[model samples]
Target: MIQHFFLLLSIQFRSFFGAVANEWENNRLKLIAGAVTLLVMAGAFFFMFRGLFRYLASLDADLFGFGTALASRLFGMALLAFGVFVGVSSLITGNSALYRSERSTLLMAMPVRRSSLAASSVLQSWFNAGWTMLLMGYPILIAFAEGLEFTTVYLSRGLLLYPLLLLVWLSAGTLLTVLLGWAGGPSGWKLFGGIALIAGCGAVVFFAGGTSSDLIIQEAPGMQLGGLQNFVSDLPGQSRGYWPHSLFLQAMVKGNGNAALILTVEAVVLAAAALTAASWKFLEAWNRSAVAEVRYRSPMFFKDGGRYSTVFQKDLLMFMRDPVQWSQLGLLTGMFAIYVINLGRFPMDFTNPYWLAVGVFINISFSAFAVATMMVRFAFPAPSMEAPGLHVLIQLPRGRELFYGSKWSQTLFLSVIPASILAWFSTMSIGAGPLLQVESVGCIFITAFTLSTINISTGCLFMRKEAGSAVSISSGQGGIISAFASVGFVLFMVGVLSWVTKKYMTDNFTELMLAKPVRDSILYLMLPVGFTVSIASFRAGIKNLRERVF
Candidate 1:
């Protein structure tokens, strides 16, 4: 029986990778393009951070041990932030693995033990989400470990501590899902959960907004550390139950063996506890998720959200009705609110026209990127969202257009509008003249429109057959390609816009060697460039669908 259970778990993993391998084999070109783009982006991010770290280290201020303490503090925050990111992401993947997977129903029908399925599902979620944490976090980590020698203690971090910590965190998410299921979860609880979440987010935004940004930076009080004595004095103080972050830093950054041992024991204890709980409760959760009528229905419980709107409106309803979808969106919105709450923290002198110009430029660029990021998640997987319903869609005339158009419209409403509002405020930050702010809004809109169009096209081209949460999809081949390609495109456009802003958006370019008419013409050329590319990409994608997809 034990052998059979292990075999079943192995099969689950094989099947998951098999699906991905098959997709990659069939679409080698697309996968290769995505891989290349991803590598490029990773390299770019690494170099960018490496440069920042070096700059900070080279700073004139020797306070806080010449930025070593500051680096440590920032790394500590990264670990905490990433731990939360991993937990939330793993939760999404866990939900998909347990309740949304196609294999779940089939495997449950077999005479397999629930523990086997739960074990396999937990591993699957770990791979799905935990890998992203490693991929994104490691570059920053290695960059910061610049001056440290390759000692045994430090090498342990690379080989042991990080992976163990990630696994423990991933298990926590799976364990939470099991407990939620055990408690007769969903239904009205989902609605209440959603409301509570929004309220909490609002409160955070309010608190942050009311707090001055300078106060935030000032309150973190740093010790002036220049040498060994300074280092000891500035070291994170020990507290009861924990040394605040000294243990974590010692284990992760300093590679202290004792700290490493502590983290190892903590990870082992956490993972063991979580897996044990999940193993016991999973079957119950599985039964409740589908078999129990109340668990199956959403909070409103009265109406089928699908019945109201048959096309575009239907997609909107679907997005709103599902808490899983909202979870991803809310996470992003909450993060954005963090910036909104502290807008005053940015040091922009409205009296200085160039500074105002730079401020607006930075804000609009960030807003555009944020909007694009949202599209790559929600819009890219839209094609797969049709899933087993493909037969139903294929039977209808012009179904692909309707579906894609609906997704595009929904993305615009949800993504573009919010991005524009933020860009408007960002423009307002520098007290920009009405004309410049309006122009900045137009530029942001163009960026959003171009990126969204490409996302829909890319999503349709690489749609998968499986059902997974947006996070899982975003982690998949299609999603990766869409995101990387979108980033590449955004970077190119931003670079161009940066030049245009410098030349035309500010006072005079003609006096600086380039004529105003020439700069104006160049900027005007970008308008058609974006519009033409968007139309061409959309048309090509639609044609591809007709030729192959139909």
Candidate 2:
């Protein structure tokens, strides 16, 4: 059984590497562009972390009097965040790699042990989910070493421990998918997942709300170091619950050989246990999942009978049928809800118009980034996802235009509503004046409009008909370009608006206090910028579609 599993894994690895080599050979420009984008992002993060650590090191208290303890706490929090992300990725990828994919079905029919198949699937999911983080992790470690002036020993220890920690997370996540599949099947798993996520978010809000009121009252006089100290103190204990991560921090940063040995033992044991459980019951779970059916009813309101109504309905159906899309969106919404809830709880002196304006600008800035993320994740893949129906689409009258328009319209419409809502609520919670509130909402609208155009255009320009998933396409070279473009634009707008608002608020403090407009403006001079960007993106998309489709 072990031999078979190793052979299968070897084949999978070879296939992956071969495909990567082919991509490099065939699309060197695109590959180089993507690599450069990733490098730039990593460099930015590296410098950011370096600056932060430099400041922390300079502090007499050594990071608010916590010393290495505080460093450990921060590292622990980072690990905790990464663990959650890896676990979610593993579960989603595991379900597909193990049970749902056509390749899995083919593998099941072969003359091999079910245990080997399950083992291979688990490892494949782990590789797919964890490899991307290597680039992210390396920069952080390098930054930590340089910033803190750590020796090679510390850096080496960290480099060794990170992948081990990732393995532990992968094992736990894979085991979860195995158990969920065995107990409730795939549909049951997704239902439970959605409910559990919603419940978890609710619990967080409840607890945050219960605790924040007193903290706000206590700190209302002024923000103090003590409250922050107490909060930081709590994190070490709270983070200890994630034993692997805590153990990793101890082993890597503190040079605890015993902790390192223990972590290694735990990782190996947990992996073996996961494999054993999969060998015993994963086959049964796989069989159960193979036969399960998911029935979803499409919305009744999609009955408009225009020339492109069918395209719209088809796109809606595609989106609705894909559980991954909606589930991730739900998670994003829950996280955003928590963010807003916490924002409202902050002890902001709303009477101070300057601070109020700052708060509103911050909210709008965050909302703009959120909108850009939505565009990259969901909107950028709209055109490529139509590959399965491309033949039919091409046969329709003015089909390319209809196809692109449907996707563009759908993306813009879906994007603007949420952007506007988030802006309004966030501003209202901060007690911004009516004029500023209107301005904030309008800024978000322009952000949405501009970003949607950029994403749809770039997506069409970089359409990959043979891609297996929306995620694969969205994480491609073109998606990186789209992301950078979106972020660069948002940063520019934020900078401009921040300067304008600060100037206006300073000049017309009394008048603004009376809830009056400070300046007659062409959107603080952002409208022309936005319009120019939108026109350029639209033209690029049209040119690409004409060349590709016609």
Candidate 3:
């Protein structure tokens, strides 16, 4: 049994490594970019922790007597919350690669006992949890105890208990995954679960912070430390009595021999029991409930042979039927709502050029993100979505042109309209001169044109062998390409706008600076040039698509 567990772990590790390595090989530049980002994160973490430790060391033991307890509790909750958040996201996302794979299926069919398989899966999950905890939580724990003069017993307990907290997280995640998988149709339920999970997490943070604040108010009245120190010192207890996190923290702080022994035993027992139950029931339940089917039907044909309206309507229907398409749009809607609320909070004087520029930039950022996401998830996948039907499409009369036109029309309608609306709202709210407003709108259209063109061109050029699952983050390289293209386009647009604005100011400094009409006129002239270039890019993309053999 032990050998079997180890074998399974080895296989899973190899599989994970291979998948990641392949992704890197195919998209080396993106992978390098991701690595650089991770490096920056590590550097930031190190500096943050070092500063925290130095600050803690400078405090007097008498004045900072309460600091130890406060820090421990805050660290514990952070660990707990991080664990829970990851667990919840995994559950909603469906650990198909880990849990619903051929290897797992074959292993289940073997003579291997359920206990061994469960143990192995639980261990894998725990390792994942630990990596996550180390990345985000360990710094806080290490910094909190730095220069505090803790005993070896306390240090040992802290070390031991960190993994145990991670195990608790793994247990929670495994249990939730099993339950959600058993429920079936993860796509339908995941949205609901994800929203609920995010909302629940926000509520937990709010209440926990509020409770801690109340506690500090009651206990340490009128204490006036600096803002950062005060925030750290006044945090709530890590957990209530007997809570897993609290027990772990207690072992770390007090380090009583008996307490350590009891917590260790309790953690092991709980983890073992959960794993056993999940293993015994999960596979059977999943097998029974995993198969979810979606049905699609073509629309009824009209008497006039449907004509142009028929083809457009068919494409529209197909778009509506796709869960991925709708989901992307739904996410965009949520993002837009958030952006509007944030915009309302900006302290902007409508007449100020600085405010106007800021508002225009924000709108551009929002539109760019939205359009990029749409293009990658929808436009780039357009060819693959047609699948075997693509052969029939090529054979139809003027099939190539119709095919390209339909996709282009869909992309335009989907990307341009909402982006224009957002740009208009931003410009009007900022009270920019008419010319500047027109220029802003033109900038948005230019951005959309460039992004949409890149999306289609890439979709035609780099066709995937299979229709990748929508939920997987690293499923397609096209998304990374889209992201890169969008960023590049935005930067280019910013440069051009800046140059044009600077040139106008240089030519007519006093009038451009003080007169709205002059500023508006300059912007209006720039708009047409920007619009023309964007249209040229769109045509170039279409030509590229026509030339490609795909």
Ranking by TM-score: 2, 1, 3
Off by over 4 Å in 3: 14-95, 98-108, 112-177, 189-196, 199-280, 291-325, 347-357, 429-436, 471-475, 498-550
Worst 10 residues of 1 by lDDT: 209-218
Backbone N/Cα/C clashes per model: 2, 0, 1
Evaluate model 1: give its TM-score. 0.76
Which digits, one per residue and each the tens of the lDDT, describe model 1 over residues 1-550? 4675688777977887897799698977876776786677677767877776666555424442434444555555556556656766666667667765677788888888778777777777778878877777667666666632222226447445677666656766666666666766443455335334433433442333221221112122463222323322332322112321345567765556687677677777777776677678576777777764532333443244342235655465567666767756776787776675465455445455655566666776777788777888787877777665766766667776666776667666766677777777767765666656665676677778887788888877877677655656666777776887787777776776677566654445222433443346336755677788788769866776677643
- The residue pairs found clashing in candidate 3 are 73-238
Best by TM-score: 2
- Rank the candidate models, highest lDDT first: 2, 1, 3
Model 1 pairs in collision:
64-225, 65-225
Q: State TM-scores per candidate.
A: 0.76, 0.85, 0.60
Tell me the deviation in Å of residue 250 in model 3.
19
Q: 1 or 3, which is superior by TM-score?
A: 1
lDDT digits (tens) for residues 1-550 of candidate 3: 6787787778778988998899788978867876675565566565676565445445435444454444454565565566565554344333453355555578777887665776676666556445645565555566556635442226656776776665655555556666555566344545346435543553464345423342232235665444334445434344444545666666776665565666677667767765666567666655654465556667675435634565677777876665445654665566565565456445454354544555665565666666666667667777556644666776778676777677777787778877777777766665656666666677777677667767665665555546554433223455555556666666666766666565445654332453453344335643554456556655755675567565
Model 1 spans with C-alpha error above 4 angstroms: 1-5, 13-45, 60-78, 99-112, 147-159, 186-248, 255-258, 292-310, 345-361, 387-400, 429-436, 465-469, 500-526
For model 2, what is the alpha-carbon lDDT of residue 54?
Answer: 59
